[model samples]
Target: MDSNLLRVPDGSESVTDADEEIFLVYTALNQKPTDQIGPDGFRGLGHVDSRKDIISIRFELTALSHPTSSLSKVAEDNLASKSRKGKSARRTCNHADAPQTIEIELAQDKTALRSRKGDTGSVLWRASIAFAQVILQQHQFPQSNPLFDKDLLRKSHILELGAGTGLLSIALSALAKSYTATDIAPLLPLIRKNVALNFTGWTYNTRLQEGSPGSNICVEELDWETLLSLPPARRSHYYPKPAEPNAEWDLVLIVDCIYHPSLLPALVETIETVCTAAKTWVLVIVELRQEDVVREFLERWLSKGTWQLFRVEGLLELPYVIWAGQKGVP
Candidate 1:
């Protein structure tokens, strides 16, 4: 891990400087070999290793379509004050059209540093912040024009695979009708705690229980290997069927989950299972760390012949890339 990667920006720095500072935090992992990366452990987050501290990171949610800029100090102070006063962040936005800031409080336990594979979910990743920013700013453009369907998230039920710290759920969940965050068993508690930390009066059930009024944001275990092994007949046994019976998930998010090569089959299979409907959209975001690994995942995805892939060219400058896929559609 590069110690300078986490350098705090000075007050005199420009928005581009600050943006580059934060961007390096997540992209730093790209310098490492893909074989050395673990499911939950990212080398870039080395500072959180073996610690149990709750850290709060603030992301200035700006429009990717425009010249990117960080929020002004005055605006940030106002939002922080409102957050401290227990006010809803939605009410704190500058106006119907202005970009808003979000502070995500998360706990990271790198105790897995001792294990063969790391549990990296306890901390926030830069890719999640970038994705959330893109989501937050999508409304600025007409619904029909963005690379990601501007209307899909607004009116849909969203499911995020390998949600990690639940940052995306915490930041954008309430905007949708429903949002479900899923990961392996070990990371569920961290996701639930982080989600609860940001959302007042929200309680999460360990598993999506039967007939219980679904919470605004739900956290459930969705191990990819488990879903892949289950016969298609038994796949619905996984918690969180689409909000409507027999309907496919409206949107599926796969951000920064493409590191380990061994998990590619399981990951692709699970995605194919959930995104069965023609309208279901899968958004896959990966840091441009290892090109070969990323190419391999894309190859497997396209080889399936069921998904039609598309890219968001607007965000080409970012260290990560976004791909949108749908099944049985041209």
Candidate 2:
């Protein structure tokens, strides 16, 4: 809940202003100390800082779940009171009483799904459950559609749909000249926090080695399920005019957003309505779990030639499919 701002060093080319900001915000959220200087005199927590051009942020479980003074005392007392009848007894008691920390990185451009470790085939972790891991993964794979090409993105106006935690949007904001980021109303606070944390100290001087003049990034509440039926009063909260139709986005992005079978149709309808003819591309990156449901949805909607399916490599080395609109076809 608390936040802090740290100034980036001038001679530091290994990390950008954005990387430092994210690191600080993440450390604060996990309730960890940030002023500790490492052996190299640089602030060290858990991320890889070797890359001079790219800013990499690392998340560690120990940093996220450091035991409080009272909790530590209780654990110590419990361990001390255990009887040493035998090595097995001591080991068993220690294992039961020991505290475990679960740490993860938030590098993904979209912070909507969490990465899992081991073969613990229990329920898969999601963005809502592990915010840190999802962010980390999104950063590693910012784009869902590799076929779209970098040249296409350079010239197009982009929109990120269901932009949870605003990681992809932030990436797009850095790449595209104009970008609009939208998600459910409830997530705006986190999205804004992330945007501010990443962009506050960023400068766009041509001489700066790390980042270009940052893009014009704006975050708003645009519910894909609501569409034009959204209340005029509520819509006005983010948009300038609620009644007027706005044709602003040329490309739409949906990352890790296709789990619910019922929402696919509504989501498509919203895309068709908001995006104009100039908006010829839609990138959807999702980890296919329920193939039956996804196949049925794609066969019904994508087969119509309105959208085309292309496969892209995911950050976790998984296969992700991207859906783009046909030029002048839809």
Candidate 3:
């Protein structure tokens, strides 16, 4: 019964005017009530008593997203201010050889932002940011690590799965010869928008792969479920085959994708399929939240025969691992 749930007790029936006021306060604060409905088949918003509490919640609503209300006007103003700042950021980036700035429009201001409950893919997860940091550190000191060997960046074709906000992919794009970010179809536009916003300097040559622009980075709709249902030969199609005659996906990057327990097996299968060639290497980073789900992924991944796992002992300040395929198996 978290506050976010906003559930009425099971015994409650019809919502009174007072009950409506409480529900109004809940929703007005940008909190969505659960699917539970009241006994009388109305919204399950039962009754509420404290007038002072309702007033306090009402005041808080101004900071949240509220359409058709005076509070929405404030939201608009804040976003306008952010836009001006965004322009300043772009100008500063152009002047200085600064790292590309990825503007994640949080639900508070951005039109593309969606509530986590509605679309978890739209939010910028910490794991994604941490993974990006790991890549930067490796790139800065490539000589120290064999995983990021001198030639890896120039020749590598990178693919990121469950790329929320496309942050990690965007960061890696500047390094890899080619990078692909994949998520569900609905999230493609938002991902593409983020790519275009950040990589303004990147060449827009879509003709890279045999008449294909071989764009440095691409955002494609790759439904994991669809891949899972495909025939065995076709399943490999989703997993990039070895491009350099010997290696499969010079490197595969995945972060924060193991939360859902049900999807663990599919995710594992996907990873195993992609790391088909012995030359392939996969770098996986999990945020370490949801201990149970993390445990499940680790157990499954540890037991999988496809990869010769290297437990990256504190390799990056962030959490991640490397999986090089079985030693010498063509």
TM-score of each: 0.71, 0.47, 0.60
Model 3 residue runs over 4 Å out of place are: 1-80, 84-118, 141-143, 201-215, 238-247, 317-330
lDDT (Cα, tens digit) per residue for candidate 2, span 196-280:
4455442222112333333355666776556646654553343312111553555666765666666776566666555445334
Candidate 3 residue pairs in backbone clash? 206-213, 207-212, 207-213, 208-212, 208-213, 208-214, 209-214
How does residue 189 of candidate 1 score in lDDT? 83
RMSD of 3: 17.0
Which candidate achieves the best TM-score against the true structure? 1
How are the candidates ranked when ordered by TM-score, highest leading? Answer: 1, 3, 2
Better of 2 and 3 by lDDT: 3
Best by lDDT: 1
Total backbone collisions for each predicted model? 2, 16, 7
Q: What would you estimate as the lDDT of candidate 2? A: 0.39
In candidate 1, what are the lDDT values of residues 206-278, reduced to their tens digit? Answer: 4333332224578889999998888888876764675556655777899888877888998988888776557
Span of 10 residues, lowest total lDDT, candidate 3 = 50-59
Clashing pairs in 1: 40-120, 41-120
* Model 2: CA > 4 A from native: 1-152, 201-215, 228-248, 303-305, 312-316
* TM-score of candidate 2 against the unseen true structure: 0.47
